[model samples]
Target: MTEGTDRPRIIEYAGNGFVITWEPARCRHAAECVRGLPTVFDNTRRPWIVTDGATVDEVVTVVDRCPSYALGYRTADGRWRSAPAGA
Candidate 1:
């Protein structure tokens, strides 16, 4: 189950032009991220998230599918992005 009341653990992976953020405590492990973008969200990897594994557009699209808001992103330009409301 996800942490509903506590602050989540946030991890970041920076790539050439974007950064990916992961909130472990909030992850449901439903594999939406993995299914959507395996190359970047492979749990078998040490760090799990390889921001450079895919293009920025690919990363953003996959992250938007995260049902728990456990995944997020920021561009090199410093624009923060996240799954849409009610997602």
Candidate 2:
């Protein structure tokens, strides 16, 4: 765990083809991610945001919906991938 008042703590989860980055301090708990992808973003579960619970595309889609910008992702090669329109 990380602690700081000046910098947000970041947690990373790696999946088969992508990595998800989360910033808890930046999260507003808006539920956009939960609404978009329940299986992967379940707040009720420990270590929420199961990177492998869904496909890379699906994860990307939900992460993009995070209103607080707390969620983000990059491909295995370190290229950022944005969600498709309407995702």
Query: Per-residue lDDT of 1-87 in model 1, one digit per residue for the tens?
Result: 776885447888888799898878779999999999898888898878876659888888888888888889998666677645655
lDDT of 2 by residue, 23-67 (tens): 887789999988988887889899887876688888877787787
All candidates' TM-scores? 0.78, 0.78
> Candidate 1 — what's its lDDT?
0.82
Position 59, candidate 1: lDDT: 83
What is candidate 1's TM-score against the reference?
0.78
RMSD of 1: 5.3
User: Which numbered prediction scores highest in lDDT against the true structure?
Assistant: 1
* Total clashes in model 1, counting residue pairs 3 or more apart in sequence or in different chains: 0
In model 2, which range of ten residues has the least summed lDDT? 78-87
Positional deviation of 76 in candidate 2, in angstroms? 2.4
Count residue pairs with overlapping backbones in model 2. Answer: 0
